[model samples]
Target chain A: MSTPVLELARVTVEFPTDRGRLRPVDGVSFSVEAGKTLAVVGESGCGKSVTALAIMGLLPQGGEVGGGIRLAGEELLALTPDQRRARRGGEMAMVFQEPMTSLNPAFTAGEQVAEALRLHQGLSPDAAFAKAIEMFRRVRIPEPERRARSYPHQLSGGMRQRVMIAMALACRPRLLIADEPTTALDVTVQAQILALIDEMKRETGTAVVLITHDLGVVRDHADEVVVMYAGRIAERAKAADLFANPQHPYTIGLLGAVPRLEGGAARLASIEGTVPDLMNPPPGCRFAPRCPFAIAQCAEQPPLAEVTPGHQAACWRAPLDTLLEQAA
Target chain B: MSAPLLELRDVAKGFPVRDALGRRRGAVRAVDGVSLIVPKGSVLAIVGESGCGKSTLGRLALRLIEADQGQILFEGEDLRGLSARALRARRRDMQLIFQDPFASLDPRMTVEQAVAEPLRLHGIVPRAQEAQRVAELLSRVGLRPELARRWPHEFSGGQRQRIAIARALASEPKLIIGDEPVSALDVSVQAQVVNLLQDLIRELGLTFVLISHDLGVVRHIADRVAVMYLGRIVEEGPTAQVFGAPRHPYTRALLAAVPGQGHAHAPLLEGDIPSPINPPSGCRFRTRCPYAQPLCAEQVPPMEGTSHLAACHFQQNLPPALVGQDAETGGERLRRLQAYFTDQTQKQGELA
Candidate 1:
C-alpha cells in the first residue's frame, strides 16, 4: 500500500482550564490515504475539530499537543515554526466551517486566494492574482474574475465557501482538511459544495479529512469512518460496514437517533443522557454511561479491538447480537 | 368534518426594504399568498430552507405578525376582527416555542417563575395553585420538579427546551407552534424531545405546528407536511404521500439531497435561491428549476391537487421516480431502527 498522505499516531490534545487540564482528544490514531476521504464523525466537543487543529499544528495557546503527526512519512511535530508555516499551504490546507469568520472581511476574495498562492508557491502578486482567477474558474465559480474581486461580504455563503475551497486547493496541497465545510450553507448549496470537494479530490488526488457531526454526510462522502464520543474513537470501519453493521453502542444509538428522510415516523431510539463531560470524564468507556448494553464489565476500559476484518469497536459488548442472545 | 383548528386564507406578508438612509427601496414579500389548514390535534410541519418564509408563516398563524392581506382564523373565528383585549384573552389558547430556548427564556428567572408567569397572566390557575401547576408542567415535559428552582443558564440545551415547552404548556394552550424547537439539540437529545412532543400531542390531544428545515424530524412528527419555497408553499400533503411520491421537482430535489439514502451525486437543482426583494416574474422556483422553460418564466403555476397539492407546471410530466429505483423506500430503515430500539429497551429492562 502507498504511504498515507497524512497520518496520526496516539494524538492527544490537552487544554488548561481553570479547574484542571482537560484532555479533549486522547490517543487518536488514523491515516488518510491520498485521494480518499476519512470522515471523523462526532457531535460537538468530540475532538474532531481539535484533532484537525492538532494535525495542522494550529492548536490555540494553552493547548498541549502530544503525539506524532506525519505528512507523507515526514514528522510534522518536529518541524520548526517557520518550517511548519511553509509546509502548511503547500503540503496541507484547511477549510473551516464558517467561511465568513475564517475569511478576512477587509480583503477581496481574489486577494485571499492569491495571498495563499503567493505565500506558499512564491509567485508574484500579478501571477498569484491570475492563478486565483484560474482556481476560481476551476471550482465552477460563475463570472470568476468579477466574483474574485468582490469582498467576502458581497459574495453569498455558497460562493464564499467556494472561494475558501479555491484558496485551500490553490497550491494543490496533498492533504485537505474541511471542518464542516457545508454546514452553514443550505441543503442545495451543501450538495454543491460536497460535490465540489469530491471533484477536487478526484482531480488532485488529495487526501481529505472531513470533520462533521452529520452521519448522512459521512455515509455519502467518506471512504473510512471514525465515530468519536467524548474525544475517543468509539468505532472505526469502512463507511458501508459502519452503516450496515455498527458495532459500538454509541454508533448504533447515533444511527437510530437520526431521523431518516426516507423513513416513516417512529419513536426515535434516543441515546439516554448527554455527552460526558470531558473535563472530568467517567472511568472506562466514555459512552458506557449512555450505553444500554453496558454491564458491570463496562466500568473497566475496553480496548478497541477488531470484530470483523477492518472493523473495530471500543466496547466490551461488541458483537452485540451474541450478548443479546445470551441475555435472551 | 369539524373546522380546522387554524386556517389561513390568502395570507400575505411583505416587509419594506430600507437603505442605510432609512428610505424604503422596495417591498420584500416574505410570505406571499399562503393558505394552509391545521386540523385539530394533528401535527402540521412547515419545511423550507432559510429565507423561504417558513418562519414568517409560523408567526402569521399566531398573528404575532399581522398579514397585510389575509384572514387568520383560530377556532373558526377571524383573529383580525378581535379587539386587543380579546386577542390577549385568545392568546391563552395558542402559544409559541422558539428555536433557541436559551434566548427565548429569561436568564434571571427561575424555571418555576417562568412557567408560572403564563399561568398568572392568563389566570389559568388560582395564584395559590400556580406552583403546583408549574411543577406538573415541568414533570410533564420530562424535567424533575425539583429542578424548577434553577435558572435557564444552569440547564442543558435539551433541558432548557423542556423548560420552554413547560412554559408553553403552562397556559394550557390548545395549539402550539414550535419554530425549530429541537434543532438546537444533539441528535440523541432531539429524539427524546421529539418523542415527548409526540406523546404530549397524543395524550393531551393538542395541535402542533412544527417549523423546521430538518426533513427527518418533520417525517417523524408531522402527519401533514408543507414544502415552502421563496415565500410560498410549493407542495402540501399528507407526509406519507408527499415523501413516498414527491411530485414537485423541488421536493424531489430536497429529498434526493438528503445524505444517508445512498444517492449518487445528483444535482437536482442548481444556483442559489433568488432575492425575495426582486423575485422572478413567474414561478418563484423557475430560476433554479431544471425543467423550467420559457413558459415557466412567463406564467405562475397554480397549485393543483385534491389530497396532495403541488404548485408546479411540470408536476405531472416529472418522472415517476426522480430518485434512483435502488433508493430505499421510506419507512424500511425506520422499521429496522424501531426494532433495534425495542430490542435494546428489552435488554435494558433485563439489566435493570
Candidate 2:
C-alpha cells in the first residue's frame, strides 16, 4: 500500500494553568491517506481544533504540543520555527470556521489569496493577483474579478468562505485542514462549499482533515472517522463501519442524539451529563462516568484495542451485542 | 383542526435603510405580505435560512416588533387595535425564547430572581409562594431546584437554556415562540432540550412557534411546517407532507441541502439569497428556483391549495424531489443502545 500522506503518533497537547497542567489532547494517533478525507468528530472543547492547531504548530501562548506529526513522511514537530513557517502555506493550509474573523477587513479578498501565493509560491504581485482571480473563478465565486476586489465585509458568508478556500488552495497545499468550514453558512451554501472541497480533493489529491461536530457532514464527506471525548480518542474506524456499528458508548450516544429527518417524531435519546472538565478529568476511561455499560473494571483505563479489522474503541465493553444477547 | 390561536392577515414590515448622515435611502421589506395561522396547542415551525425573515416573522407574530401593515389577530382579536395598557396585559399570554441563552438571560440576575420576576409581574402567585413556584418551574424544565440561587454565568449553555425556558413558563404563557432555542447547544444537549420541550408541549398543551433552520428539529417537533424565503412563505403544510413530498422548488432544495439526507456534493440550488432591500421584481425565489420559467420572472406566483400550500407557477408539473438513500445506521439496535445511554434503569435491568 502507498504511504499515508499524514500520520500522527501519540499526539499530546498541554496547557499550563496556575494550578496544574491541562492536557486537552492526549496520546491521539491517526493517519490520513492521500486524496482521502479523515473527519475528527467531537463536541466543543473535545480537542479536535486543538489537534489541528498542534499539527499546524499554531498553538496559542504557553501551550505545548508533544507528539510526532508527519506530513508526507516529514516530521512537522521536529522542524525549526522558520522551517515550519516556510512549509505552512506551501505544503499545508487551513480554512477556519469563521472567515470574517480569519480574513483581514482591510485587504480585498483577491489580495488575501494573492498574498498567500506570493509568500509561498514566490510569484510577483501582479501575477499572483491574476492567479488569485483565477482561483476565485475556480471555486465558483460569481463575478470573480469584481468579487476578488471586494473586502471581506462586502462578501456574504458563503462568498467569504469561497474566498478562504481560494486562499487556502492557492499554493496547492498537500494537506488541507478545514475546521467547521460551513458552520456559519446556510445549509444551501454549506452544500456548495463541501462539494467544492470534495472536487478540489479529487483534483489535487490533497489529504483533508475535516474537523466538525455535525455527524451528517461527517457521514457525507469523511472516509474515516475519529470520535473524541474530553480530548481523548474514544473510537476510530471506517465511517460506514463506525456509523453502522458504533463500539464506544459516547459514539452511540452522539449518534442517537441527532434528530434525523427520516426518524419521524421519535423521542430523541439524549446523553445525561455534560462533557467532563478537561482540567480535572476523571480517572480511567474518560467516558466511563457517562457510559451505561461501565462496570467496576471501567475504573481501570481501557486501551484502544481493535474491536474489528481497522476498527478501534477505547471501551472495556466493546462488542456490546453479546452483552445485549446475554441480558435477553 | 382546532381554532387558530394566532393569525396574521397580509402582514408586512419594512425597516428603513438610512445612510451615515441619517438620510433615509430605501426600505428593507423584511416581512412583506405574509400571512400565517398557528392553531391552538399545535407547533407551527417556520424554517428558513438567515436573512430569510423567519426571525422577523416570529417577532411580528408576538408584536415584539410592530408590523408596518396588516392585521395581527391573536385569539380572534385584532392585536394591532389594542392600546398600550391592553397590550401590556396581553403580553402575559405570549413569550419568546431566543437562540442564544447566554445573551437572552440577564447576567446579573440569579435563576430564582429571573424566574420569579415574571410571576411577580403577572401576579400569578403571592410573593410568599413565588419561591415555591420558581422551584416548580425549574424542576419542570429538568433543572435542579437547588441551583436556582446561582447566577446565569455559572451555568452551562444547556442549563442556561433550561433557566430561560423556566422563565418563559413562569408567566404561564399560552403561546411560546422559540427562535432557534437549541441551536447553540451541542447535539447531545440539544436532544435533551428537544425532549424537554416535547414533554412540556404535551403536558401543558401550549401553542409553540419554532423558528429554526435545523430541519431535523423542526420535523420532529412541529405539526405544521412553513418554508419561508425572502420574507414570504413559499410552502406551508403538515410536517409529513413537506418532508415526504414537497411541492415548491425552494422547499425541495432546502430539504435536499440537509447533510444527512443522503444527497451530497450535488447542490440542488445555486447562488446566494438576493439582497432583500431591492428584491427581484416578480417571484422572490425565481432567482434560485430550478423550475423557474419566464413567467415567474414577470409575475408573482400566488399561493395555492388549502391544506398543503405552495407558491409556484408550475408546482403541479415540477419534477419529483430527489429520493435520499437512507444511510442505514442499524435502527432497532441503535435505539436500544441509545436507550441504555440515557436510561440507567435499562442498564440495571439488564444486569439483573
Candidate 3:
C-alpha cells in the first residue's frame, strides 16, 4: 500500500494554565492519504483546532507539543522554526474559519495572494500577480481581475473565503487543512465552497484534513472520520461505516443529537452534561461522565478497540445492546 | 377556521442608507411586503440566510421595531391601533428570546432578578410570590433554582440560554419569538435547548416564531416553515411539504444546499445575494436563479398555492430533480445509522 501523505502519531498538545498543564489534544493519531479527505469532528474545546494548529506549528504561547507529525514521511517536529516557516504555504497550507479576520485588511486580495506565491514559489512580481488572478478564476470568483484588485472589505464573505482558498492553494501544497472553512458562510455559499475544495483536492490530489463540528459536512465530504471528545478520539472509521455503525456512546449521542432533515417530530436525545474540563479530564473515557452505557470498568481508561472491521471505538460497553440486555 | 394567533399583512420596513456626509443614499428594504399567518399553538420557523429579513420579521411581530407599512395583527387585534399603554400591557403576552444570551442578559443582574423583572413588570405574580414564580420558570426551562442567584457570566452558554428562556417564560407569555436561539450553542447543548423549547411550547401551549438559518433545527421543531430570500418570503408551507417537495427554485436550491443531501456537486444559485438597497425589480432571487427568464425580470411572480405558497413563475414547471420528493429520505439514512448502535449493542449482549 502507498504511504499516507500526512501522518500524525500519538500527537499531544498541552498548554500551561494557572492550576496545571491543560492537555487539549491528548494522543491523537490519524492519517490522510493522498487525494483523500480526513475529517476531525468535534465541538468546542475538543482539541480539533488545537491539533490542526499543532500540525502547522502555530500553537499559541505556552503550548508544548509532543509526538510525531510526518508530512510525506518527513518528520515535521524535527524542523526548526525557520524550516517550519519555509514548509508552510510551500509543502502545506491552512485555511482558517473566519475569512474576514484571516485576511489582511490593508492589502488587496490580489496583492495578498500574490505575496503568498512570491514568498513560497519565488515568482517574479508580474508572474505572481498573474498567477494570483489565475488562482482567483480557478476558485470561481466572478470578474477575477476586478475582484483581485478589490480589498477584503469590498468583497462579500463567500468571495473573501474564495480568496483565502486561492491563497492557500497558490503554491499547490501536498496537504491542505481547512478549519471550519464554511462555518462563516451561508448554506448556499457553503455548498459552493465545499464543492470548490473538493474539486481542488481532486485536481491536485492534495491530501485534505478537514476540521469541522458539522457531522453533515463530514458525512458528505470526508473519506475517513475521527470523532473527538474532551481531547480524545472517541471513534474513528470510514465515513460510511462510522455513520452507518457508530459504536461509542458519545458518537451515538452526537448522531442522535443532530436533527435529521427527514426525521419528523422526534425529540432529540441530548448528551447530558458539558464537555469535560481538559485541565482535569476524567481518568477513564473522557466521555464516561455523560455516557449512558458507562460501567464500573469505564473508570479505568479503555483502549480504542475495533468494534467492527476498520471501525474503532473507545468505550467499555460499545455495541451497547449487550450491556443493556445483561443489565436487564 | 379560527383566526390566526399572529398575522402579518404586506408588512414592509426600510432603513435609509446614508453616505459618509450624512446624505441619504437610497433605502435598504429589510422586510419588504412580507405576509404570513401563525396559527395558535404552532411552531412557525422563518428560515433564511443572513440579511434575509427573518430576524426583522420576528422583531416586527413583537412591535420591537415599527413597520413602515402594512398591518401586524396579534390575537386578532391590530398592533398599530393599540395605544402606547395598551401596547405596553399587551407586551406581557408576547416575549422575545435573543440569540446571544450573554448580550441579552444584564451582566450586573442575577438570573433570579432577570427572570423576576418580567414577572414584576407584568404584575403576573404578587411581590411575595415573585421568587417562587422565578423558581418555577427556571425549572420549566430545565435550570436549577439554586443557580438563579448566579450572574449570567458565571453560567455556561446553555445555562445562560436557559436563563434567557426562563426570563421569556416569566410573564406567562402566550407567544414567544426566538431569533437564532440555539445557533450559537454547541450541538449537544443545542439539542438540549431545542428539546426544552419544544417541550415548553407543547406544555405551555405557546405560539412560537423561530427565526434560524439552520434547516436541521427547523425540521426538528417547526410545524410550518417560511423560506425567506433577500427581504421576502419566497416560499411558505408546512415543514414536511416545504422540505420534501420544495416548489420554488430558490427553496429547492436551499434544501439541496444542505450538507449530506448528495446535491453538493449540483450548483444552486450563483453569486452572492443581491444587495437589498437596489433589489432586482421583479423577483429578488431572479438575478442568481438559474430558471430566471425575461418575464421573471419584468414582473414579480405572485405567490401560488393554498397552504404551500411559492413566489415563483416557474414553480409549477420545475423539473423533478429540483423538487426533491424522489430523493433518498434522510430518515432512511438516520435509521441505518441508528441500526449501527442497536446492532452493536445486540452483538455485545450475545458476547456477554
Best by TM-score: 2
Tens digits of per-residue lDDT, candidate 3, A199-226, equal 9999999999999999888988999999
C-alpha RMSD of candidate 1: 2.4
Q: Write the per-residue lDDT of candidate 2 for residues A1-328, one digit (tens) a residue.
A: 8878899999999999987999999999999998999999999999999999998889999999888899999999889999999989899999999999999999999999999999998999999999999999999999999998999999999999999999999999999999999999999999999989999999999999999999999999999999998888999999989988898999998888888786453688777777888888889998887777889999888989999999999999998888778867
TM per candidate, chain B = 0.93, 0.95, 0.92
Top-lDDT structure, candidate number: 2
CAPRI-wise, candidate 1 is medium
lDDT of 2 at A287: 86
lDDT of 3 by residue, B108-222 (tens): 9999999999888888889998888888888787777888788998888988898899898888888999999999999988988997898789989999999999998998899
**Fraction of true inter-chain Cα contacts (below 8 Å) kept per model?**
0.53, 0.65, 0.53
10 residues in a row with least lDDT, candidate 1 chain B: B324-333
What are the clashing pairs of model 2? none
Give model 2's docking category.
Answer: medium
Stretches of candidate 2 off by over 4 Å are B263-267, B323-326, B345-352
Segments in model 1 whose C-alpha atoms lie over 4 Å from true places? B323-352
Ten residues in sequence with the least summed lDDT for candidate 2 chain A? A262-271
Sorted on TM-score, highest at the top, how do the candidates line up?
A: 2, 1, 3
